[model samples]
Target: MSHTPATARHLLRRPDGDTTPRFSYGADYNPEQWPREVWDEDVRLMREAGVTVVSLGIFSWARLQLAEDVWDFGWLDEVMDLLHAGGIAVDLATATASPPPWLTTAHPEILPVTERGETLWPGARQHWRPTSPVFREYALRLVTTLAERYAEHPALAAWHVNNELGCHNLYDYSDDAARAFRLWLRSRYGTIDALNHAWGTAFWSQRYSGFEEILPPRLAASHPNPTQQLDFKRFSSDALKDHLRAERDLLRRITPDVPVTTNFMVMNEMRGMHYADWASEVDFVSNDHYVLPGPRSLDELSFSANLTGNIAGGRPWFLMEHSTSAVNWQPVNRPKRPGELARDSLLHVAHGADAVCFFQWRQSAAGAEKYHSAMVPHAGADSEVFRSVAGLGRVLRELEPAAGSGRAPARAAILFDWESWWAAEQDSHPSSRLNYKQEALDWYSAFLDLGVRADVVPLGTDLDRYDVVVAPVLHMVPQPLAKELTRWTENGGHLLTTYFSGIVDENDHAWLGGYPGPLRDLLGIRIEEFAPLLDGETAELDDGSTGTLWTDRITVTDTGTEVLASYRTGDRAGGPAVTRRAAGRGTATYVSTRLGPEGLCPLLARTLQAAGVPGDLPESVRGRVELTVRAGADAEFWFLVNRTDEPAELPGVTGEVLAGDAPERGEDGEAGPLVLPPRGVTVLRRAAARG
Candidate 1:
C-alpha cells in the first residue's frame, strides 16, 4: 500500500552546479582483490570509462574483520578517499554479506540447516541462517561499525545492505528457524484452532494442539501439507525481510540523509523473496538482472525489466548488476557479441532504470568468476568490451535530459502474483510440468511478437488503467480477489485467464461445486475435472495448433458464452478449448489448454482487436523491433530496439536522435526513416505523444 519514500536520482552524485539529472554508470569496485599499485590504475581507467559511481566492499567481511576483537579500516578508508578524489561516488556496503572464517568457526550454531537435517558448511557465501540470533548480533555489529565510520564521508551516496538477501539461504530448517516459524504462525493465525482450520490438518492426523507443535515443512515420509509448505515459504521470505529492516534502520538512524537499498534478484527462478511486498520497505527499489539463454531470452529480459519498473511504482530504479558478457556460472559460458553489451544496458534504461552497473569492474585472475567479463577484461583497456563500455558512457551522458522520467503505461497488462506461483508448484499437484512463470511469460512473448506494448504488473495494481488484462495460472484466488476481478470485468474491462485459476481459496481448499470455483459464473463455463497430459504428448486444436501440459473438460453454463476455439483431437473431442462471455460492455475469456507463445499469437491478435488495443509499431515492422517509451514533462522518449541480427527500417518517424544509431535526413533537412543496425538501439526525443 505504501510507495517509495525517495527516488534514486535524489541520492546519486552529479556535476557541480548542474541541475540536469545524470544517469549513473559504473560497476562494482573490489580493491581488495588486487595489489595496492593496481588500485591507482583502476581509478585512472574508471575515469577514462566515465564511471560515475561504484558499489564498494560488498564481499569484504573476512578482510575487514579479522577476529572478534580485531577490525581494519585503513585500506577501505583510502579507497573511499581515492574514489571521491576521482570524482566518483561510493555506494558503501555493510560488508556483512558473508561471514568470516573466524566468526563461523566460533559460532557454528549460526550455520544453516537443510530440510534433510544436514548442516551447511561455511565454504560458500551466505552460510548464516536468517533466524539465528547469534548471526544477527554479529551482522548488526558490523553494520553499525560501517554506518558510524562513513556517516559524514563526502563520497557516501547510499547504503548497500547485505548483497542479494536470501539468494542461497532462503529455506532453513534449523532449531532457530523452527522457533521463528512458530512465532510467525502465531502472528498470522492468532490461535491454534485457526491455524488448524487454515492448514486443513485433519486429513492425515497432522492436526496440532498448540502452536509449539508446529514446525517448518521438513522432509517427511510423504508430501507435507500444502498450506504448511506455502506458509513456510512466506515465513522464510519474511525472516530475510526482517533482517533487511534491521540493517536499514541502523543506517537510517546513523546517516539520515543517505538512502538505503538492497539489490533484488528478479531474474528467472530467483523467487525466494516476494519482491512486490519488499519494494515498499526500502527507500527505493534496486534489481540485479541477468540474461538467460533460450529461445525467448530477449523476451525474458524485457519481461523482468518491465516487472522491475512496475515494482518500483514506475519510479526510476537502479540496475545493480548484470553481465558484461558470458557469466561464469552457466554450464557453457559463451562470450557476448559485439553490440549486446550496450543493447542490454540501454534496454534496462528504456524500462526506467536510471543507474546502470555491472557485477565487477575488472576481470579477476584468481577467483571463481575469473572467466566472467567485465568493463576491463583480462586483456585490459585495449579490448572490445572496454571500448564498448566507454562508448556507452558517452551515450548515457548525451541522454541526461531523459533522466528521472517515468515509464509510460501500456494498454494491456499481465497480472503477476507471487502467492499463486508459490502455491501452484507444490509436490502433490495434478501435473509436475505446470510452470506458472513460463505460462505468464508466454503471454508476454506473444504481446511482444505482435509489437504490442504491455506492462507486467503485480496483482494489486490498479486494473482500470488498462483495457485488457491477462492473468495466467492464477491457481489460488481468495474470495476478495475474486470479487475484485468480477467488479472490474463488469465495469467494462476485458479479462483473460487460463486453466488452474480460481481452483482454491486462500487456505488452498478446493471449491466443492466445480473447478475454477470463484470465476465459474464470470467465465460462463463449468469444469468438473482436469485432464493433465503426460510428457511428449499434446492435444490438437481446431485452430491448427497443438496444446500441451493441461486441458479442462468444460460445459457452457451461460447463454452469452461463445466458443471461439475447440479441441479437435483428445479425450474431450469437439469440446470448447477457448470461450468468451459478455459481461456488461466488456468480455471474460477462458483458455483451458497450454499454448506456447508462438501458438497464442493468432488468438491474442483477435483479443487485442476486440479490446481496442493497438500495437505501437507499424504492422510491417512488428516482431522485428521492440518499442518502449518513457514520458518526460514536455516530450516522450521512444526506444526502438532491433531484436534480430539484421538491419531494420522504420519509415515516417520524426524526432531528434539523442543516442545510438541515428536515422537519415530528408532532402529538406527534415527527419527521415530510421534505420536500425543489427542488434542496435535508437532513442528519439519526440513531441508529447500517447502513452
Candidate 2:
C-alpha cells in the first residue's frame, strides 16, 4: 500500500509560524436579538466563555431585506463591527434560507406545496420551491450581496451557505418541479425506452412513451412498488443536490478562498442526501448532533462524529450544531448532566473535530426552539449553563495551543455508501423494521469495542491502505464497486459483508440473478431463500446459541467457502449462518443473519486478530479508557480518554504525559498504569511503525 504524505492531506492551517489555536470554541450567536447597548456585554460573556467564533446571520433574512426593493443593513453592520472589534472570528451566513415575507408575498410561486398538494403558508421557513425561478433569482441576489459586502472582511473566517439545505424533503409535484424532473431524467436515462426498462413501467400499464409522459413516482399505499419508491427517493436527492450546487457555485465565484459548507443532520434516513455526492463540492463537512436522554445517545453521537470526520478523509471538520444542555425538539427534552457536555466536546476533538460549536448562543424569546438549551439561558449569564461555558473557556485557553496543533492517526477504514443505504430500505421484501443506521452502528460498535481506529470511508476509497474493510448491509451492488471489492480481495485484503447486501443496483432495481447479486462469486455462497423471523421468534445457531431477527438458507458454491456458523433449529436448522471463503491471497466472510452483541463479539474479535489488529486491554480498563492512534509527520499521537467517573489506571510500557510531567516517558520495566480522572483526555506521542 502506498502512503499519502501528511503535508498533502492537511487542508486547513494557521498563518505560517503562528501557533494553531486549540479547536475554536463557540456557538451560534445572534446579536440581532439584542440591542446595540447589549453588544459589549455579549462580547464580554463570549470572551468569558472562551467563545472565539460566532456563526452569525443564520436566520437574519427578515432584517437583511425589509421590503420588496428596499434593503436594510443598519443593525447587521453594527453587529459585525462590534463582533470584529471584540476579536471574535465570524462564520458569516448568506441568509438565503428564510427569505423575507415580502419576496414570498410578491411571488406566491416560490412557496412549496406538500405531497397532498397544499401550498405552505408564508410564516414557515424552508417553504420555498427550489425549482421556482423567483426563488433562484432572490437566493442568488441575497448570497451575492452578502459575499460582495464581506468578501474581504478580516473577521470572516468561513462562509456558511443556507442553514441546513433541504430541511424539508423535495415534495413538490407542481408543474415547475415536474418539468425539472423531466429534464434531469432526460440527461440521465438519455432515452425514454431506457427509463421505461429501468423503472419496469410495463408492469402496471404505465409505460412512458416519451419524456413528457413521465412523472415523479407517487405511490398510493395499496399499490406501492419498491422500484418506483426507490426511483422517487433518488430523484428527490438529485433535486436537492441541484439546489445546493446553485448556491455553492455562487459562493465560490465571490470568495473562492473561504471554505463553504452546510450542516448535515446525521442519521437522517429520509433525506436520501449522501455525503459521497455532497462531499465533492463541500470544502469540509459539518454536522448537527442532538443526543437523546439515554446511554445509547453517547455512542450514537460518537459514531456520527467519527463518520463525518472520516467522510472528509481525516480533514478537520466542526461540530456545527449541538445543544448546550437540553433540546426542545424531542417529545421529552432532557438536559445533559454536569460534565457530559464538556466530555462530549473533548471526545469530538479527540476523534477529529477542529471546532466545537452549538446550535444557538442565546435562547430564543419565541419560536419552536424557544426552549432549546443555550450558552446563556433566557435567565441570563448568571445561570449554571453560563458558568459551565466560562469554566470550559478557561480550560480551552490554557490547552488550545498543544491540543489544537495535533491530529489523529487512523490505520483502518470502514466503507460507507449512500446507494447501498437507499437500496436496502427500498427493498419490497424483508422486514420493514430493518434499520440501516442501527446496522451500521452495530458494526461500528464492534470496532469501537476493540479500540480500533477506523475511518468510515466512502465506497470508492482506495482500499489498499486498510488491512480489513467492513461493509455492513451493502444492499446495492454498483458494478464498479463490486469490481473494486473483488480486486481488493484478490490483492489479499480481508473484506467482511453482512446479510441483505448486494441485492440491488443504483436504481434500486434487483439484479437479474439470485440474491447477493455480483457479490456471490466473491462470497462463494448462493442464497436460496431468506427467513425473516417475527418479533418474538428465534433461530438457533450451530454452536447451540440461539439467533433471532432473521436468517437465510444458503449453499456453498465453491469448495473454498467454509461454514463458520449455522442455524440450530427450524426447517432450515443447521443451515449456514456465517461463511468464509478464500479468494486469491485474501479471504471474504459473509454473515447470513443479523447477530446481537453476544453473537457478534467473537466473530469480530477473531477477524481483528486475523487482520493483525491490536490486542484487547485488561478487562478492568476496557470501557473506562479509550485509546486511538493517528499518524503524524515523523511520529504518532495516541489519544487516551477516560470516560468513567473515577480516575483509572493505564497500561505499562507506554510514554506518559500526565498533567505535570515533561513530554517524556520513564522506561520503567513494569510501571503501574497511570490514573486518569473522569471525562479527561490525554495525548501521548510515540514513533510510528508500519504493520
Candidate 3:
C-alpha cells in the first residue's frame, strides 16, 4: 500500500454539501449486545449528547455470520436505517475483528501459537494468527460482503478496516507465521547469506544456508540472537500490517468513495506495531488510549496525543476509544474525578483530534468488558457518567471551529523510533530496567513543565523543521540516520542525545572503537566503558541534580567540547556529566546519566534558551498549565489545560472564548487574567499572525 496523506481524506459527513466545520462525536455502538428496543433509546441519547457519528458492528462477526453459508443482515439493516433517520452517521465496521465460532472451529490451524508452543483458543478477541491463510480468506470474505452490501448506504461515513489489529495476537510462532517470517526475511535481506551476516549467526553456529531453515524467534535456551529477535519483531508488525492492507484494499475497491481507518493502540507500552510505519496505510489515523494510573498519567496522556497528532502529519485524527470514567481492565479501576472527564476529552481536542469517541455507546451487561466505562454507563443515562458524557458533547459542539485545524509546529521535538525502542530494551543489555518509551515521555513532561511546546515526532521526520531535537536512548544508529543527524547539526540544528545511544548499528552490532560510536565525532566525546549503576545507587552532579540507572565515563576528544556539568560524587568524580560541542552554527550536547523529569528541568531550561526556543506560558503557570495550539488559515485556537488540581491564572491573555469561561472584566471595562478551573481545559481563539 502506498502512503496517503490523512488531510486528503473526507473525514466527516456533510449534508447537501454543507461546509460548516463540526467535531464528530459518539462511541462504538454495539447494538448486537443489546435488544432492538434499546437501540432507539441509544440514538435518542446520542442526539442529545450531540453525536454526529458512531462506529458500528466492530465485534459482530459471530452475530452477522452465524455459519459458513448463513448470513444475517436484517438486524444490521434496521440499525443502519435507525441511525441515519436519527441524524447520525456511521463509521461502519468490516466485522472482521474476530472470526465466528464456526470458522475458527473449522480451521483450527488459524489459531496463534505462543513462543512456548501453546495454542491460543477462541474465547478471547484477536485469537487468530496474522499470517494464517485460512483466516485471511474468511476475513476478506466478510469484508467483501459488508462492503458490497453497504456501498451506497446513506449513513455510511467511513469504513473501519479491523479493530486494533495485533492487539492480542501480534507475535505468533505457529507454522503459518514461520512460513510468513521466512518470506518476509527473504524480502528484507534478499539472500540467505545477507540474512546470516545481519543476524551475526556465525557466533552461535546459528548460520543458515537457506531461508527455509529459519524459524520465528521461538523459545530458546540461554538467549536468542538479538538481531533475530529484532527482525522477528519487525516481521510480526509487518505481518499484521499486510492483513490490514488486504481488508483495506478490498473495501476501497468495493466502496471507493468512503474513507477507511483502523484504531491504533498508541498508549503506554503497546509498542507491538510501529504506528509510524502503519499511519500511511490508512486514510486517517485513529487511536485507543486508556490512562494508566500514576503521577505521570496526565503527562503520558498528553504525550501520546501529541505523538498521535504528529503521526497523522499534524492533520486531524480520531480519538476512537477512551473511557467515560473508570476502565474495567486495570488492577483497580478508579472512576474519573469531578472535572477529569471533560478535561481529558478537551485535551485531545487541543492536540488536533477532530473526533472524540469512546469504546461503546452502552455498557455491556454480559461480557468480559462488562465493567468497563462507556458513554452510557451501567447506571443508565440518568447517572453522573452519562451526564458528563453529554456535557462533553456540548463542549465539542461549541468548539466545532477547531475541527479541521492543524497543530502549530513547535520549535523543538523529541524523536520517537519504534526500531530503536525495540532494540534498546532487548535482553542481554546493560540494565534490564532501561525503558525507552519512559525516557522519551520524561523529556516530554519536562517540556510541559517548563511551558515549552515540543512535538514528539517519529524518527524519520524532517529535522530541519526544528531548532532543537532531543533523541533519548537512540540505540540503533544506521549509516543513513547518522549522516542525517550530522547534516542536521551542521545546518544549525541543536542535537541533544542521552547515554546508551549511538552504540549499535542497524544489525544490533556494536559500533567498533568506543561507546556512543557513530556520534562520537559529532558529540566530540568518547567513552571506553559504560558505568551503569546498581539499583538504588545514585551519582551526584555539581549542578545539584542526581542521576541513576546508567552513567558513562566521558573522555572529550575535541578541543571545542565544553563540559556543561560534572559529577560531584560517585565513580569517576569530577568527570563530565553533561557536555556540549559546537558544530557549524549549532551545538551537539550529551547527557551521560539518567536524570528524570524533575531533574531534567534545569538542563532543559538552559539548553532550550541556548537554542532560542520560546516558552508558551508565563512563569507562574509553567507547570500548572499545558498549552497546545491548533491553527487554521485565519486564527489559532489555544488550549490552556490545567494540569494541577488547583485553579491556575494566566495573565495578559486575550482571545475569544470558545469553550470554558472567559476572563472577568472590571468596572473600567478592562479584562482581568484568565483563570482556569481546577483540572479544567479552556480553548481560546486568537487571530493568526501574518508575515
Candidate 4:
C-alpha cells in the first residue's frame, strides 16, 4: 500500500492520486450538533446537493471525549458510515479545534492569557493558549484517538488538523508562553550577549542579563523593544506550527495513506505565522477566505485568491470556507447580490482553486454564527442562496474539465512578506502611515489594471522564474537575502522597491551606513533623511500626480544610474525622488516616496516594458472592469469581471463562453467587445487549433 511521505514532498496530491475527484464540493459537517435521527436526512441532502466531500467533526472535541479516559466514537462511526453509504467522502477532523470543557476546567491555565494579563474565559471556542503544554497534551490525545479509529475508513479522504490554529490565542503572555519564548530566544540567539545586541536592548538600559529574565514585550514604559516584539511574533507562530507538526506526525503514523491539511486564514495571516514557512509541512494547503466588504470587494478577493494560489507553490488549493452570502463576523454584514455567489466562487477557480466549499452545510439554529449564510439557508432549499448553491454544485461539476491545470506562470513577481508586514509599521517609525499591506495592494491592483497576472509571492521564493520583481514595502532585509537579490538583479532580473524598504534588519535596527542599507548599492542612491508628510499632506511629482505619506531625500552615489521621477515641489524637490541603476545585465528602480497607484502605476508600466513583459493596455484592464487570463497547454481562459454595479464591455475579445456566456463576441469569431452585466463574471475558454 502506498503512503503519504513524512517530509516536504509528502502527499501533496490526494491519496488515491489521479483518480481522486477532480472537483469536489461540500461544507463543514457537524452531525454531532443534530440528533442521530437527523443524520440520515443530512446524508441524503448532501447527495442531492452534489457534496462529494464533507469536513466532519471540526468542533466536536467535547462530545467525542465525553470524560477523561472515556471515549465515544459510536456517533462518529455512524456518521461516517452514513456519509459513505450516501456516496460522500470525508475530510475528517481530529476533533482538536477546541479542548473538552472538562479538560479546560481541570486546567484553567490552558486558557489563553492576553498581553494585558487577563485570562480568556472558555465560553467560546479555541480558548486554549497555543504554547500551553496542558492544551497540547489534551489536544494530542484527541488527535491520536481519532487517527487510530479512522486510520483506514473508506470515507476518509484527508486528515484536517485543529481548525485555524492560533486564530483566537495567537498571542498568549502566560507563564507557559514566557517559558517557551525564552527557549525560542535561546535557539535563535545562543548567548545573552547576542540577544542583547540583536534587540539593541542597551538602549533605555534594557539589556538582558539572561534569556530567562526576558518577558514578552509587556506594556512597556515606552514602545516595547522592537526586536523583542518581533521575536515574540516569531515564537508565537512557531509554537502553533510545532503543535501542527506533532499532530501531523501522529496521523501519518496511522492513516499514512490519507493526505493531511489544516485550513489557513491566508488572506490576513492574522498572527504573523509566515505561511510560506508552514507551506512545506502540510500535505496540501487549504485556505478560508471571506470577501472584504467595500467598493473594492472583488479586487480584494482576486488579490487574496492569487496570493493563496502563489503560497501553494502555484498548485491548486481548496477553498475550505467562504460564506454562501453575508457573514456574521463583519461590522456590516451585506448579503451577496444575485449572481455574486457563482461569480465569487468561479474567481477562485480561475486563479487555482481545485475545490469550492462553504463554511457550513446547514444554518445553525443557535450560536455565534447562526446568522452566517449557508448552503441550506434558514429559509429552506427553495431560497435564492439554495438555488445558487445547487447551481454552483452543477457548475463546478462541469468545471471539472479544468481541474489540476497549473496556474499560469508570470513574467512579474511581487514580494509580500509577513515579517515585513509585522515589523514595518511597529509603533516607532518615521510615519504611522507607513501601511505595508496597502502599499502591496496598490502595486498589485496596478498590475491587475494592466492585465498582468503577477505572482504575489513570498520573499524566499526563487527569483529566476520571473523577469521583473516588485518589492513594495520590504522594510526588513537580512544580509543573506539582500545578497541573493543583488545576485539576481546583477544576473538580469529587474527589481522595483519602494521608500520604506531595505531600511532595517530583522532586529528592527537600522542597516547602519545608509537608509536603505543592504540595498544601497543596487539602488545606487543613499537616503539622507526621512521626510514623511502628515495624513493630509501631498507632494507634487513629475508624473503629474502627487505622492503622500512618506518621502526621502535621496542622493545618487553612482554615475551610471538615471532619475526616473523626482519630487517637483518639496524640500527634496528634483533631488532624485525615484532612481534607476543598470546593475550589470539587469535594472533596479527605487521609488523614494509613497506614490499611490496614480504615481506608481505608470512607473510600474515603464518597468514592465523594460523587463519585456507584454500585456494589453485595454480600457477593461485599466477601468472599472477587471480582466484576468489563465492558460493551459491547450486553452486560454479569460475571466472578465465587472467590479461595479454598472455593466462593462471588453473590446476586441472573442472566445467560447465557459461561464456567464459573456454578452457576445462579434459575428462568428470576429472581434468585438465582451459585455459583462452588473457585477457579473464571465469565463471564456479559447481552444488552441490543431497543427
Candidate 5:
C-alpha cells in the first residue's frame, strides 16, 4: 500500500492556486431588511458567527429601484461600507432576480402568465418573463448599473446574478413569448421544412408552412403532442439561458476580473435547463440545496455535489444555500439533529465545495420564509443557534484557508444529459413510473456504497480517462455521444446503461431501427417490446426476486452477449432483465427493467469487480455512513459522515482528530469503529493508495 501523505492539497483550492481567494465562510445577509441603527449589532454578531463574507441584495430589486428612473443605493452603500469596515467580503448581487413592482405593473408583458393563462400579480419575485423585451432591457440595465457601481469596490469579491432563477413553474406563453419561440425555432432549424421533420408534424397535420404559424405549446383543450411539449421545454430553457447570457455579457464588460455566478436549484426540471448548458457561461457553479427529511437526503446531497463538480469540470464549487438548523418548507419542518449541519457542511467541502454558505443570516420577520432557519434566529445573538454558528465560524476560520485549497481526483464518470432526461419523461410507451432521478439515484448509491470516486459528467464530456462509465436513462442518443460510448467500450472501458436508455433522438422521436437505437451494436441486444407494469403489480427477476415498474423483452444479437437477469412478466415472463456484451477489449451491460436495490446492488457490485473496480468499502463503515475521497499532492482526505442520528464507528487504521489520538484497534488488528454521535462527522487523512 502506498502511504498517502496527509497533505493540504486534497482540500478545495482557488483557481490560481495562489492569488485567487479561497471561498470563505459566508451567509446571505439582507441588512436592507433591518434599519441602519441595527448594522453594528448585526456586524458584531456576524463576526462572532464566523461569517467572513455576506451575499447582499439578493431580493432587493424592489427596494433598489422604487421608481422607473430613480435608483436608491444610499442604504446599500452604507451596508457595504460597514461590512468592509468589519473586514467582511461581499458577494454583490445584481438584484435582477425580481423586477421592481413598477416594472410589472407598468408593463404587463414582463409578467409571466401561467399555463392556465393566469398572469402573476405583483410582489412575487422570479415572475418576470424571460423573453419579454421590456424585461430584458430593464434587467440588463439593473445588472449594468450594479456592475458599474461596484466594479472597483474593495469589499466586492464576486458578483451574484439574481437569486435562484426558474424557482416557479410558470413560463409565459403570451404573444411575446410565442414570437420569441418562433425566432428561437428559426435559429435552430433555419427552415420550416427542417422543423417539420424534427417535430414529425406531418403525422398530425401540423406541418408548418411559415414561421408565423409556430406557437409555443401552451395548455390546450386537447392533450398536446410530446414533440410539441419537448420543443416548448427546450424553448423555455433556451430563453432563460439567453437571459443569463445577456446579463453575464454586460457584467463581464464592467467587471472582467471578478467571477460571476447564479444560484441554481437542484433537481429542478420545469425549465429544462441543465447545469451543463449553464456551466459554459458561468465562472463557477453554485447551488442552493434543501434537504428534505428523508433517508435519501445525504445521497441527494452527494448527487448534487457530484453534478456541480462535474459542471465545474473538476473545478471547485460553492455551497450557495444550506439550512443552519431547521428548514421553513415541507409539511413537517424538523431541526437538524445536533451536528448534522456541520457534518453536511464538511461533506460539501469533501465533495469539491470550496465555500459553504447558508440561505440567510437572520431569520425573516415576515413573508413566506419568515420561519426559515438561519444563523441568527429571531431571538438574536443570545440564542443557541447563534452559538452554534459562532462555533462553526471558529472552526472554519481555523481550517478553511488551508483545507479549501485543492480539488478532488476522480477516475470514474457517470453521464447525465438533459436531452435524455426530457426524452425519457416524454416517452408515451414507458411506464409513467419510470423516474429519471430515481434511476440515477440507484446507480449513484451503488457507487457511493463501494466508495468509488466518480464524477457525474454530461453527455459530451471526454471519457478516455474513466475506467468505467454509467449512463442511466440515456433516452436521447445523440450521434456524437453514441459514437463516443462505442469508442470507449471498444477501447476496453467498462460501460453500463440502465432501462429506458438510448431510445430517442433530440426531437423526442423514437429511433427507426431498434430499441437502444445507435447503441444496439455496442450493447449487442435488441429490445423487441416494452412492458409497462401497472400500479401494485410486481414481476420477478431470474434471481427469483420480484421487480416493479416497466420491463422489456430483449434478444441477444451477438455471440458475446449473455443474459444476466431475466424478467418474469406478461408474455415475456422469462425474458432477460439484464444483459452483457463483450465489445472489443471491454464490455457493456444493459438493464431492461427498473430493479430494486436488492436486485440492483449485487449486480452492480459484481460488474464493477469484474471491471477491476473496487466494489465495497470496509464493513466497519456503516451502511448509512457515506465515505468520499478527495486527493491532494501528498495526501488523500477521507470524509466519513453519518447523515443520520444513529451512532456509527469509524473504520480501523484511521487516526482520530477531534478526539486527538490514534484509534484503538480490535482483536482483528482493525481500529475499533468510532461511534459517530447523531449527525456527527469524522475527517481522516491518510496516504493516497489505489486498491
Candidate 6:
C-alpha cells in the first residue's frame, strides 16, 4: 500500500511549534475483535496507509470492566503501547456508549424504555438511558477509569466521550424520564398554570393540575400536544447533553490538555438533538455523516459538511466517521462508484474539515456490521477500497496548505433551526409531508447550482454578517428574532423567508393576527391561506417553472411589494407565489411555494445579483460542479469539484493547483477551461494581488 508522510493533525499550534500536522487520517480501531497476533498486523497496515490516529474502545467497557468492582486494563494498555510504537495517535474513547450485559442484567431499569412501555434490550449498543442515575453511575465510572489510565499516554490525541449520543435512546419514556420531564417543565414554566397555558391543555380537558401530572406524551389517546412534543424533543436533547457534559467534565478534569468531543449524526431526518445549544460545550466538534444514496447525495454531503463547519464557528472540524463505500446500516447499502472515495473525502476538506476518518479500520468477521465497508475491506489490503483509502490519505496530506483555512466569506446565509424542524414535522399539521429540512435544502441546492458558497447558519447567529439571509420554512420565528430580522433588512441586509414561516411562536402556538405573523409587515405581504398540493399534484408559475408539495395564497398588503412571480395555475391562480419588497436599502423576498431546483435557481441567481453577491461560474461546470472557497488571512483557496460522472470544464485563472486532478495548461500562459475527470477535485490558490 502507498502512504503519505507521517504527521499528526490540526487545530492547536503552540508558540514553540510543538503542533501536529494540518491533516490527520485514521479510522475506528477495535482490537478486541481480533486476536493478539492480528493487533501487530493492524498497526502495520495502518502505517502503510498513513494512519495517524484511531478512535479506540468506544464500546469496550464489557471487556475492560468484568464486574461492578472488578477491572482489567492490561489489554488496553498493550493496545495503546502498540499503536504508539507504530507511531499512531489514539483518540481514546470513554467506553460509555455501550454498557456491559451484566450491568443491564442486574439493573434492568437502567435500560431505555420505549414509548410503548417496553424496555430496549441490551443486545444493541447504547442501550442505557441518558437520564437514568444508574446508567450515569456505571458510565462515569468507566470514563474515570479510562481517563486516569490513558491521560498521559503518548498515543492519546482526543477523548471521544460517547458514540453518537441518543442515536436510538433519544426519548426514553420510562418512569425516570417522567420524573425528569416534570423537573424540566418546572424549570421551564416556573408554575403549573404557565405549563398548562404553554401546552394549551385547556382545549380537551387535559389540563394538568401540577407539573407532576405531565407525562412523557407517550401513547397519547390522540395526537399529542404539539408544544409538549416540542418540549419533549428539547428535553431529550438536553438530557443527552447533560450526560455528555458530565462525561466531558470528568474527562477534562483528568486530562485538561486533551481535547474532547462526541460525534453527532447531523441530517435532515435525524432531528432529535439541537446541536446549536451543544456546540459550545465541546473542545471541538466532530460529526458522523453518511450520504443517503440518491441523486442529490453530493449536494446533501456538501450541505452537511458546510453546516458542520459553520456550527463549529468555521473552525476546521473532524470528519469522525464516513464510509469508504457501502454502509451496512442502510436498507439497500450501495457501494461507492469508482473515484468517489477520494472525491467525497476531498469535498469535506474543501468545506474546512481538518481530518478525514471512517467508522472502522477493518471489517468485522462476525456481528451486525459485518457487511459494513471499512478502511480495509474484507477483501484485504490489495482491494479497491484500500487503494482508495490509501489514495485519499495521500491527498489529505497534500491538503496541508489549506488545512487551517476557515470557510470563505459568504454573501448569503440560511437559517437551520431545530425548533422549527420539530414544530413543522409535528402530527396534525396542515400537511404531514411538510419538510422543513427539504425546503432549506432547496435553497441550498440553488446556491450549489450557482457555484456559490452559503453558510448554513444557526437561528441566533448574528444576522449582520451576510447580505442575503434565506429562511425556508422557518415555521416558528419568535417575535424577538423576527424583530431582529426586520432590523437586519431595514439596515440593508437582504432577507428571504418562505411558506409556513413566522406562523408559530417558540411555544409552538400560531402567531396571532395573520398567517405570517411577525414578518408580515416587513415582508409587505399577507398570506390568507395555505394551498398545499397532494403528492402527485404540481402547479405552474409565471416563469413556466413548476412548484410542488406546497403553495400559499398571498396578497400584497403593501404596494411597495413587487410580485416577481405568481401562481399561474390552480384555484389560487394569479396569487403571489413569489414576491420581493424593498426594505430600507435592500429587498425582502418571499417564495410561498416549494419550487424545487428547476424554479429556484434562476430566482436565487437574480436575487443574489441584486444583492451584489458574485456567483459567476464557467458554463460547462455550472450545474455539474461545485465551487467552494476557503479564505485565510494570507490567501484564498478556491476548490473546483466535478460532481458528475462525465468530464466537466471550468474557466480557469492563474493559480497554483494545491492538490488533486490539477487543471491542464493552455497556450500563452492562459490556463484553459479546467477539464476535471469524473469525480475529480482541484484546489487553486489565488494570487496575492487578488487577495
lDDT of 5 by residue, 224-255 (tens): 67777887878887777777788877877777
Clashes of each: 0, 5, 0, 0, 12, 0
RMSD of each: 2.0, 4.1, 1.6, 2.7, 4.9, 3.8
Instruction: Report, for every candidate in turn, its global Cα lDDT versus the true structure.
Output: 0.90, 0.73, 0.91, 0.82, 0.75, 0.85
The runs of at least 3 residues in candidate 6 whose Cα sits more than 4 Å from the true structure, single-residue gaps closed, are 1-17, 665-671, 688-691
| TM-score of candidate 1 to 2 decimals | 0.98
As a whole number from 0 to 100, the lDDT of residue 151 in candidate 6 is 71
Once model 5 is optimally superposed onto the true structure by TM-score, how far is the C-alpha of residue 303 displaced, in angstroms? 0.7
| C-alpha TM-scores of all predictions | 0.98, 0.91, 0.98, 0.94, 0.92, 0.96
Q: Assess candidate 5 and give its lDDT.
A: 0.75
Report the Cα lDDT for residue 418, model 4: 89
Candidate 4: tens digits of C-alpha lDDT, residues 129-153: 8887887888887888888888767
Which of the two candidates, 4 or 5, achieves a greater lDDT against the reference? 4
Q: Relative to the unseen true structure, what is the Cα RMSD of model 6? A: 3.8
Model 1 agreement with the true structure over 194-244: per-residue lDDT tens digits: 999999999999889999898888899999999999999999999999999
- Pairwise TM-score winner, candidates 2 and 3: 3
Q: Model 1: clashing residue pairs?
A: none
How many Å off is the CA of 585 in candidate 3?
A: 0.6
**Candidate 2, superposed: residue stretches over 4 Å from native:** 1-22, 219-225, 268-271, 398-411, 544-546, 616-619, 643-647, 653-672, 685-691
What tens digits encode model 3's per-residue C-alpha lDDT throughout 551-662? 8999999999999999989986999999999999889999998899988998889889988887888998998899999999899999999999998999987799999988
**369, model 2: CA deviation in Å?**
0.7
Candidate 5 Cα misplacement greater than 4 A, ranges:
1-23, 268-271, 401-406, 568-571, 655-675, 688-691
Candidate 2 lDDT trough over 10 residues, lowest sum: 1-10
